[model samples]
Target: MAHIHLGEGSFPLWALVLWTLLGVGLISAVVYRVRKGGIKTHQIALAGIGAAASFAIFQLNIPVWGGIHMNLTGLVGILAGPLLGALIALVVNIFSAALGHGAVGLLGANTLVNASEAIVAYYAFKTLMGMDWDVFPASASAATLGLSAGAFLMGAIIVISGVNGSALPRGDLTVAVAGLVGLNLGVAVIEGLLTGFIVQFLASVRPDLVGLTDRDTREETTGVTA
Candidate 1:
């Protein structure tokens, strides 16, 4: 929900290069981990489906917070796992840029923003579930937390990069970005609820698809043994 809408040349050359390099590094690490760990066949299938869904949702522009949109990156991370989820973010941004939805130059910065959401959400959800929380509450809380993280990261990138050609001073820019971040938090609650319902429905019918079966089995076994 925190996609940057700035056009090309919005950031200075140094900022662009710096962000691009960082993004490349992140992707490279993810690729190496995926190769070393070897993804399961089901996870590969899930990644494909998550990529398609994430791309589709990325296109639906909701007219809020100066034209924001839902990315569903949290759900993608939850279903596809972090490594594949990060890849899905890259793929969705690439397609979006190709279609004129986002600027091609900011792909690196944007990828980092969306990827953080997925990564945080996946870990947060797992942690909450491990603490004996119910699926709906845990998933919903994790999704909200994930979106919030993306929103803050988006604000930080904008502030640090300092948009070129903008007349506002650094202090003013930080204030403005803070306002935008607040608006995004509001949007996150709505999107988070939507994600929660979708995940809960999937868990009800296909627990294995969401990686809930193993958790459930372990809990049941512990109860019997205890």
Candidate 2:
């Protein structure tokens, strides 16, 4: 209900083809990585956990103007890393589709959009850490950036599909884009604060789950050891 649920006719053939290729490539890469990493039992369990969490949370519709839901994309990326995060997104989308949440025709497109969010969040968090920012600010900014990107992509998909069918009114694309941006920006702010606080708590209580160390903290620890 939250995601764009454009049915079979919404996307052009070229767009569908492109999205399918992209999804396949990404999935292949993740599978290769997991294979190379030796596929530990714990790793599989962790990935299952992330996928289940994403699937469950994705179903909780909030009934905003655009029917937005709590995505938790960035949080999963922070915990699972980019590859597993992307996999989780696809799994969630597929499962959601089964329950009449998102459209089966848009599966590839939806997977690309959500997977990109996870990748962005993971890399942005690492970049912020490399710049010596603390965990909370880094995570919050990453979540905001990731969600903003997802929002933009979602708007684009809606506009393109709508335009293809002349379903939108004259110049309504601007209004749609603006509305999505504004709505997502508000959601991003809330998610940012939530991610920041949750990350802080995880860092203190279960750094193993966070799997991140502040550069400054690491350097200090190194110096102490030296």
Candidate 3:
């Protein structure tokens, strides 16, 4: 079975390097694509929607599913790539923390958690798009899976940080675990619905986004992946 969390010793410099590379590279490519395309109106609008969603999630602090917080920033990650999603979450977290939403020192960790969600969502969404399955259902399902996995991973990382046993009252590890899993499951359903709607809308209105690859059926989801 996969380890629930990477141990302290497990957080080697190499791992951080790889993760940073993956995280930064993912975002850079998406930015490059948008810039290369000459900044279409829809892309800008999408950026705005993504930005607003990130801010809303960051500000709202309703504790649910046994102390697990629900944030649509996971959905933001699904809609946008890691870089922009992480950047958006960072901005939101910074402002929210300033306004007293979360711990100030925790901003870096928060960005890491939320950004990981976006990275997973971006790749999983793209990979599903590359497959032979029906576009809408496949991508939607993959998006949910990606977000859920990220939530789970993020929860584990917090535990590894020993915040579970910290004097700070974030809640016990068991309670925190339950909340994380619960939030992920709930968020999955929401993102799945949203993804289905958005992808269908894009398909109908902007078919160019899903261009054909060499094969009649096969298509590249992200040009940067290759």
Candidate 4:
């Protein structure tokens, strides 16, 4: 949802290099962590499924807010965990760029934007669950917050990088970006509700799939003991 649809050279050369390096650094760290910790077979399968779903949704641009699309990165994060979710973001963006839906050069910036949503959503979901919030509300709130974070970050990046060949002043550009971010927040709500329903359904049918089995079991045992 936070994709920058600008062309290859839309960003200044220096900004391009800087964002690319930062994106690379983030991926490198994730890779190292993955290697050190090792992912489960199920997680790898989830990652594959997430990447496919994310890529499919990425192409179906809604005709609102300058044709924004839902990333579903929040849902991905919740199901697949943050590391795999971030990787899914990268993969989806790369495939989208290949199809000319997004700028190839802006992969780094876009990946950071989407990956942040996944990472934030994953932690937020865990935090809410830790507080004993129900699945529907927790997932909905986490997804909304995650998408909102990405929207603001997208605005910040655009403002900081300064669009090439644009006549808009810095102040005006910031304001414009803010408007776009605001629109994205509106879209986030709709997507969040949908995610909530899906997560709730999954939790009901397969708690283990959503990492809820242990919590549910513990609660059941406590009730029995009491």
> Largest lDDT belongs to which candidate?
1
What are the per-residue Cα lDDT tens digits for candidate 2 across 1-226? 1257555666777777777787788888887987788544554666787787777778887776646776788877877788888888888998888988877878877887888788888889889977878889999999888877887787776666553575678477768666866787788778877878887798778776666544435777778442
Best by TM-score: 4
Better of 1 and 4 by TM-score: 4
TM-score of each: 0.96, 0.86, 0.64, 0.97
Going through the candidates in order, what is the number of backbone clashes in each? 0, 0, 0, 0
Once fitted onto the true fold, the runs of candidate 3 whose alpha carbons sit more than 4 angstroms away are 1-45, 65-70, 164-176, 209-226
Q: Which residue runs does candidate 4 get wrong by more than 4 Å? A: 224-226
Per-model CA lDDT versus the true structure: 0.90, 0.76, 0.56, 0.90
Tell me the tens digit of each residue's lDDT in model 4 across 133-154. Answer: 9999999999998988998988
For candidate 3, the TM-score is 0.64
Candidate 4 has an lDDT of 0.90
Give the CA lDDT, 0 to 100, for residue 161 in model 3. 50
TM-score of 1: 0.96
Better of 3 and 4 by TM-score: 4
Off by over 4 Å in 2: 38-43, 161-164, 213-217, 224-226
Give the lowest summed-lDDT range of ten residues in model 4.
62-71
